[model samples]
Target: MKKVVVTGVGIVSPLGIGKQANWDGVTSGRSGIGPISLFEPDEGLITKFAGEIPEFDATHWLSKPEARRYDRFLHVALAAGLEAVEDSGLVIDDSNAQRVATILGVGLGGMPFLEETIGQRIATRKLRRVSPFFIPGLIANMAPGLLSIYTGARGESWTATSACASANHAIGASLRALRSGACDVALTGGAEAVVCHTTIAGFNAMKALSTRNDDPATASRPFDSGRDGFVLGEGAAVLVLETEEHAQARGATVYAEVAGFGATADAHHITAPRPDGDGAVQAMSMALQDGGLAREQVGYINAHGTSTPANDKMETAAIRTLFGDHAERLAVSSTKSMTGHLLGAAAAVEAVFSVMALQQGILPPTINQFASDPECDLDYIPHQARKAEVEVALSNSLGFGGTNAAVAFRSAR
Candidate 1:
């Protein structure tokens, strides 16, 4: 099997626009969640706050015409993907364009666009009034399709849609492509922009979002007794991945090795994780076994702590089941407590944080830890960041439909 490595990463998160900005925010325990300013909430809407990138202007990264044609999701995807390629310093010219792949994960694409178009069509009572770009603009696969056209990389281009676990699946597929010699380089991650009426209303109906409109910053209290629900977040992230030999031949700087990936289905529930956390335990165990790592070697875990009662307790139980005595020693944290939940893009951004943690020897903090939940007992690196040497890190993403995925990374040094 070919050794895969992560050469570059790009982030368009609520924390900030770029990688450095997000790092600073997480390390400083700053929360990016706030009031919902994108649209005025109706009187009946329960959750009015979200982790939105209010300062993100599409014109800054895309031309006016291009910005006008696509949805917000595509704009963020292209921006992050281009930034990743530029960071990697990998020239995709005629010599190696065919060996590069673009793959991304997206859960709900262009909900705002769909809502607007449907409204306009209903109001006018004319189906032909819809814009020609409506279908292409809202489809999930267009993210990677447009990226391939923009970067001129033709190896394989596609999108993975698995709800919240979408990004981890995309990264896992990229690992397979590199290992099988299908592609020497891959731009893989996830993008999502669903901070709109339909998404909010749907989640609100399901009671899946936090209703702490008064204090939005402290709403995402993962593993805390006061945690009500998760805060919806919007963003995109891209990681430049390549085989070890291919990266070394080009002298690209390696941040961490893409050691292994593991995915499983709970076969238990639609939205709720198994109470015993059997599926999560299996996913993490498989990830460690695939990476040839001992359970004790994993120093950090970026948990799938969504600030929900069921998820937090289940994930904690899963960790305890998998690592046993070593679970207490692990430095665990949930960046979601600060950045909110970015839906499908959550795992990708978490993966970037995990890599950064390995490189900098600093553990990002899980803020808003007011009161702890006894069932969810762990270090959690609460309230403030901690400086520590971490040799191996694991990022876990558990999504809807009982999907669970984990990706492991090792320090390049």
Candidate 2:
């Protein structure tokens, strides 16, 4: 298999609009959660708190006419993809455009726009009133399609959806494609912008959102005893993945190696994780084996700690099962404590965080961990950042449908 490496990364997250800003905020232990401003919600909708990316001006990133046709998800993906391509320094000319593919992961694509269109149709009873771009804007695959069109990429382009694990799966799949000589380069990541009234109400009704409306910043307390549930967040994250030989030939800076990827299904439940964390453990072990590394080699972990009661404890248990004694010494932290849950986009951003940790030798913190829980007993690196020499890092992402993925990254020496 061809060696794969990440040459560039771009992010449009709740913390900030670009890679630098988002990383700075995450390392500094800043919280992006705030009062909802996207739309008005009723009292029962639980719209008071969310990790919203504030003041995102699509027109600034895209042309006015293009911005109007695409949905917010596509706009964010295109903006981030452009940034990643520019950062990678690989020119996508006509000669090699056909060898460049785009794979994006999205959970709820154009959900708000679809809801608005349905509402208008019901109110006006005129199906023709909908814009011609409605269908293109609402499809999940449109994010990658728009990217391919904008970049003149004529290779395979599609969207992968596995709930929150969507981005990890997409990135892993893209790496496989490059390794197999199917594509020379790939743009892979995930984007989401589903923070709307109906979505919020649905999560609220399911009791799956934090109710800390009065204190938005402290709402997403991962591994904390007082935690209730996850706070919804929105954004996009993209990475430039290429074979090591290709990147070296082009003199591109290699961030880290895409060492291994493991995916598993619980086959147990739809919304909740397995009680014994069997799927998570299997995924982690498989990733380690595939990376050709032992358990002790992993220096840090970017946990999928969604600030939920079940997920935090279950993930901790899974880690302990796989790492054994090394679990206690390994530095584990959940960036979600600061960024909240981006759903489909969560894993891609967290994977970026893992690679950054391996590169910079710093572990991001799981902020808002006021009181530790006995169930989640590990070095969470709570409430503050830690400087450590990290050579290998693991990022875990679990989704709603019992789908779990674990990715391992090694520093480029």
Candidate 3:
């Protein structure tokens, strides 16, 4: 089997744009959640905050006319994908373009775009006023489609829409393809731009969002006793993956090894997690088993602590059940404390953070941990970063419809 390794990473996070900015923000425990700047929230909207990128112009990556053709998700997808290719320094010419795959995960697609075209524009004007780019920009697959077109990767291109686990599934699929010789290289990740009025309204209606409008920065206090719920966020991330042999043959800089991937369905709830955390335990165990790593081998876990009442406790119980005493030793954290919840893009962004942790030998802190919940007790590396020699790291993502996914990363060095 071909060993899967990461060569490059690009991020479009609220922490900042690009890889280094996100690294600095997360490692320093900076919170990006604040009042929504993407659009004016309804006066009576319960949740008024989100992790939105301020002053982002899609024309920076796409031409003016091209930018008008696609939705925000595709815009960020192209930007992040291009940045990853440049960071990897991989030349995708006529010969190797066919050997490169592009798989991007997107959960919401162009909901905002569709809503605007149908609800607002069409309602105010005639159907003829609608732009012709509506369908192409409104589809979820266009994130990968536009990214592939930009990168010239013609191999096995598609998108994953597995709710929040979309990116993990996309990454896992690319690893499988690489191991099976289906592709020599893969550009895979996720993009989400659902911080619009409709998304915020919907999540608020379901009580899945935090209503801490008074204190936006501290709203995403994962595992904290006074936590309310996750804050909606928008971002995109792309990882350049290639076989170990291929990467070495071309002298590419290796970031980390994609040791194992585990994805499972909870089959229990649509939006809530099972209290027993059985599916999460299975996913984490499968990742360890697939990587031939014992529970003690994993030094850090980028937890899916959504700051919700159910998820944090469930994830804590799952870790304890699977790792025994090692769970106590693990530096578990939720970067959602800073970036809010990026929905489908959460796994991809957290995967990059896990790889960064292994490479830097540092664990990013989960800030706003002033208080703790008894059911969610663990070494959360709270409020501050910690210096640790991390060898193996686990990134977990649990999504709606009981979807659970875990990906294990091993230090390249």
Candidate 4:
């Protein structure tokens, strides 16, 4: 198999608009959660808080005409993809552009747009009232499709949806394609912008959202006894993955090696994780085997700690089962506590955090963990960042469909 390395990364999250800004916020233990400002929630909505990307100017990333055609989700994806491509510093001309692919994950694709169109149709009662670009803007695959079109990348382009694990699946699939000689370079990541009435109502009805509207920052407290549920967030994160030979040939600065990827289905429940965390353990074990790494070599873990009771405890159990003696020595943190839950984009953003940890030797903190629970008895790096020499890092992402994925990364020495 070909050696895969991350040459560049991009992020558009609630903390900030760019990669460095987001990293600084995560490392500094800042919280981005606040009351929802996109739409009023007084109209019978249970949850009224979200982690919205503040001060975002769509015109900065998209042309006025282009912005009209695409939805907000596509705009985020395109902006992040462009940032990743620019960071890679790879001069992809017409001759080499065909070798670059785009694979992005999106969970709720254009839900806001769908709702808007439906409302318009009901009010006007005209079939021709819908915008011509509505269908293209609402498709899940259009996230990557827009990237390919903008960058002139003619290689394989598609979107993967595995609930919250969508981005990890997309990144792992891109690495496999590159290793199989299908593509030399790829842009992979995830995006989600579904903080609207319909989605919020559904999540609220299911009791899956945090209702701490008074104190938004303290709402997402992962591993804490007072934890309630996750705060809905919207953002996108993208990465540039290239073959080691390809990156070296271009003298690109490699961040870290995409050592391994493991995926499994719980086959047990639709929303809840397996009671014993069997799927998570299996996924972590497979990732270690795939990376040819020992359990002790993993210095840090970016956990899927979704600030929920079941997920936090189950993920902790899974780690203890997989790592055994090494579990206590690992530095684990949940960036979600700071960035809120970006749903499909969670794994992609955390993957960027893992790579950055290995490169900068700084572990981001799992903020908002005031009172630790006995079940989640691990080094969560609570409330503050830590400086550690990390050689290898693992990121875990679990989704609602009982889908789990673990990705391993090694420092580019």
Candidate 5:
């Protein structure tokens, strides 16, 4: 199998825009969660805070006409995708366009679009009230389709939707495609901008969001004793992937090598993880086995610590079950503590942080750890960042429907 390496990464998260800003914000233990500004939360809504991108304006990233044609999710995806291609210095001309692929992961493609269209339809009480771009703008596949059109990459373009595990599944598929000689370069990641009314109301109905309206910054306290639930976030991130040989030929700077990927299903529950964490345990183990990576070689883990009672506890159990004694020594941290939960885009953003950790030899901190939970005991690197040289790292993402996926990375230095 050909070795796949990450040449460039682009990110626009609650923390900040681009890689450097996000790296600085996360490593400094800053929290990006704040009060919900996108929409007015009614009195009945339990959660009012979220990790919203305050400075994001779609017109700044896309042309006025293009911005009006697509949804916010597509705008963010194209922003990150263009940045990744520029950062990687990978030219996709007529000769090499067929060997490049564009794949993105999106959970709820355009919830705001649907909500707006429905509102207009109801207000006008007319079938022809909806815009013609309604169907094309809101579909999940259009994210990758627009990205391919913008970047001129003609190999394969599609979107992967697996709820919160969507990004990891897309990345895993890209790795397999590259190894199988299907594409020489892949523009892959995840994007989501569903912090609108309907999405928020839906998660609120499930009681899956935090209600710490008094202190929004500290609401997403993953692994904390006082944690209530995850704080929803919105963001997008893209990684430019190329085989080791291809990257070296182009003189591209390699950030890290994507060593392996593993995916599994619990077949247990729709919204809750299995109590035994059987799916998560097997997923991590398979990532190691697939990469031929020894258990002890993994020094850091970007955990899927959702700040929810069920997820944090189950993920901790899964780690202990898989690594046993080695789990104690691993520097486990959750960037979600600061970025809130980016849903489908969470794994892609975490993957970028994992690569930055390997490159800079510094572990990003999981902030707001005032009180510790006994069941979630681990070296979370709380309160502040830790400087350490890690040779290998893994990023885990567990979603609803008992779907779990993990991707392992090896430091290129």
Candidate 6:
């Protein structure tokens, strides 16, 4: 099997616009959650806070006319993909460009555009006013389309629209392709730009969002007793992946190896996780086994702690069940506590954090963890970052529809 490794990463998240900025924000325990500014939420919307990118200029990537032609998600993918490619210093010439693939995990696609423009036009009975770019903007696969166009990655261009587990699945798909000798390199990650009124209202209606409007910074308190629900966040993240041989040939700086990937479905609920967390356990177990690593070998876990009551509790139980006593020794944390929930992009960004932890020997913190819940008793590494040598790290993404994904990363060093 080909040894796949992560050579570069780029992000445009609420935490910041670049890789270093995002890492700085998460490790410094900065909360990106704040009152909605993209669009005004409805008066009764309880969850008014979100993690939104404050400043994004498409001119940095696309021209004014080009930016207007594509949707926001497309712009995000292009920007992040370009950054990842540049960071990797992987020259995409005619010889090796065909072996490159583009796969994206998108949770919600073109939602903001649909909510802000098309929906309004149709509601007002101006159906003809819908722009010609509607379909181009709305489809999830278009993310990969833009990425492939930017990176010239013609092979296996697609998107995994698995609700929340989308990005991790994208990463997994890329890993499989490379390990199977299908593709030599891939730009795989996730992007989401749904921090709009309709999304907020929708999550609020489902009671799946935090109502901590008074103190937006502490709204996403995963594993904390005072936590309510996840705060919505918007961003795009991309990782440049290539075979170990390919990277070494190009003299790329390898950060971590994609040692293992496991995916499973709860088959239980649409919006809730299994009560026993068996699915999560299975995913984690398979990932570790596939990675040829023991539970004790995992030094840290970038948890999918969505800050919701059910997800936090179930994830905790699943961790305890999987690793038993070793779970206590792990430095577990949820970057969601700082960046909020990036929905489809959550796993991609968290995966970057996992790789960063292994590369830098510093773990990101789960901020806003003031009070702990008895059920979630573990070393959450709350409120402040910690410096520790990490050998192997697990990044978990459990999305809606009971989709669970666990990725194991081994230190390249």
Colliding pairs, model 4: none
Candidate 6 lDDT trough over 10 residues, lowest sum:
39-48
The local lDDT score (0 to 100) that residue 282 gets in candidate 2 is 95
Instruction: Report lDDT per candidate.
Output: 0.92, 0.89, 0.90, 0.91, 0.91, 0.90
TM-score of 6: 0.98
| RMSD (Cα, Å) of model 6 | 1.0
TM-score of 1: 0.98
27-142: candidate 1 lDDT, tens digit per residue: 99999999899889888889999999759999987889878778889988988898899989999999999999998999889998888867668777878668888899889999
The numbered model that scores best in lDDT is 1
In model 5, pairs of residues that clash are none
**Superposition TM-score, candidate 5 onto the true structure:** 0.98
Collision pairs in model 6: none
Candidate 5 Cα deviation (angstroms), residue 381: 0.6
Off by over 4 Å in 6: none
Runs off by more than 4 Å, candidate 1: none
TM-score to native of every candidate shown: 0.98, 0.98, 0.98, 0.98, 0.98, 0.98
lDDT of 2 at 376: 94
Instruction: Write the residue-wise lDDT of candidate 3 on 132-215 in tens digits.
Output: 889998799998888888878899899998888899888888888998999999999899988787888888899989999999
Q: What lDDT is obtained when candidate 3 is compared to the true structure?
A: 0.90
lDDT of 3 at 84: 91
Q: What RMSD, rounded to one decimal, does every model reach?
A: 0.9, 1.2, 1.1, 1.1, 1.0, 1.0
